[model samples]
Target: MDVLSLIGIILAFVAILGGNYLEGGHVGALLNGPAALIVLGGTLAAAFVQAPMSVFKRALSIISWIFFPPKVDLIGGINRVIGWSMTARKEGLLGLEAVADSEPDPYARKGLQLLVDGAEPEAIRSILEVDLYTQEGRDISAAKVFESMGGYAPTIGIIGAVMGLIHVMGNLADPSMLGSGIAVAFVATIYGVAFANLLLLPIANKLKAVVLRQSRYREMVLEGILSIAEGENPRSIELKLQGFMG
Candidate 1:
């Protein structure tokens, strides 16, 4: 689980609640169910209209990534790649076949297979680079999905507020309920702004960060494959890949 994401959201809510309590404000004032339905439901409906069905589904998946990020053990992967390269050098390209067989990651396995099959260094780089670009594009699309939601939320909030105000105005003749009607009307705006700023945008940024980190690993894999193809020393390849991390 991503502790930072959890902590960030918790702290945001806690700070707001704490400030409200300190000001002697009753929590019940912020607990209007109708307001939440207006803001949240309206925003979701607007988002469905703004984004394609595929993009909407992708956004939902990316939101989960905030709590459970992709796990990539870079150091371990690098060590294994270096070890295989050394063995290939000492025992010939065929030696890498064994390493490839034992490897679990399809990316690394594919790289080793190319190396063992006598693929040119440039060809290996091109293949891996294309794959890297494809993966990056997918990640970017996922981030854009949330970004679209962020774009829609604020406008939806405005729509909700307008609807609430219209309803309030219709009931203006009821002097006893005028104050409560106005309060409920403003709650929709509050919900819209809060959800957009606190949840959607932050999740988009977090997904971008994860994509960048994964891109770094792909870069390392590219360098390792190219170095091994060129018959460079395995230690030299390790150092080259390490530079990317730092």
Candidate 2:
């Protein structure tokens, strides 16, 4: 579980609620269902119009990453690859073929396949680097989709508030309803600002962090594969990769 995400969200809401309580403001006034629907629904509609279906799907899948990030196990995966490379060096390229078959990660599997095929060091590096670039670009694009939504949501909220004010203006004859109408209208703007600042933007930042960390792992893998291909000592390759980490 991503304790930091959970704690951050909890703390943000708690601070708001606590501040309201200390100010003698009733929390019930903030619970306007229609305002929430307008803000959330309008924001999502705008997102759908701007983002691709694949990006939308990826965003949804990654939303849970805000609360429960998947483990990457980077050090362990690199250690395994380094071990295999050492064994292959001691035995032969053919010896690493069996290790590759048992590998789970597609990236590592592809690297091993190239090694088994007797691809040169430069060619192996080129293949892995290309795949790394492609994956990094996709990750960045996915995050940017959410970031764009964060940028759009506040404007949608303002629109909702204006619509609410129009309805309120139409009912000015009932002075008692004026305050509620204005409060509800402004609620849309609040929702928009809160959601954008608290959720969408944060999610984009988290995904960017995840992508950078994953890229680091990919770099380590590239170094290991290239070193193995060039017949460098496994210990030397491990040290070289560790240098990148530190």
Candidate 3:
């Protein structure tokens, strides 16, 4: 679990509530469920229309990343790759067959298998880069689902606000209720903008960052694997791949 993601979200809400409290506002003022329903439901509807069902579903599934981000251990990965390089040097490429079969990451496994099978470095690079980009595309697609929702949410919120205003307009004779009515009407807009800026867009960008790091790690593995296949020194391979660590 990534504490930063979870902590950051909690902190954001805490700040929101804390600020609200300091401003002489009650918590109940922000608890307009109807406003939330309008903003969220309309945002979802808009996102559904913007993307295919599969993409939308996939996007929702990955939302847990906001709390439980997927992690990569670059230092450990480099060590693993260096171990494989050492194995290749000591026992030749065929020695990697067992390790390749045990490799957990499919991309790493495939690249290792190719190296063990004496595939050309150019061919390995081509195939691995394609595979990396393909997975990157899928990750980005998932992120875009949230991006679309974030994009639509504010507009949907405004529409909800307008709808609420129209209702308020219909009841304009009740002067005593005017203040509360206006306040309620604007809740949808608040929900929309807050959700967009605080959660959806941030999560989308986080997913993009995750995908970028994944791509970098995979590319490093590809480079290391190719170097190992070429009988390069393990130290040299480590040096080349370590450039991607940060």
How many backbone clashes does every candidate have?
0, 0, 0
lDDT of 3 by residue, 114-182 (tens): 998899989998999999998889889989999888999999999988888887898899887676667
**Which candidate gets the maximum TM-score versus the true structure?**
3
Error of 1 at 172 (Å): 2.3
38 Cα displacement, candidate 1 (Å): 2.6
Model 2 lDDT tens row, 188-227: 8988888899878988999888888888888888888888
lDDT of 3 at 86: 91
> TM per model?
0.91, 0.93, 0.94
> Which ranges in model 3 have alpha carbons more than 4 Å from their true place?
176-180
Judged by whole-model lDDT over C-alpha atoms, candidate 3 comes out at 0.88
- Candidate 1 deviant stretches above 4 angstroms: none
lDDT of 1 by residue, 80-133 (tens): 779977897899888999888888877778888999899998899889888888
lDDT of each: 0.81, 0.84, 0.88
Of 2 and 3, the candidate ranking higher by TM-score: 3
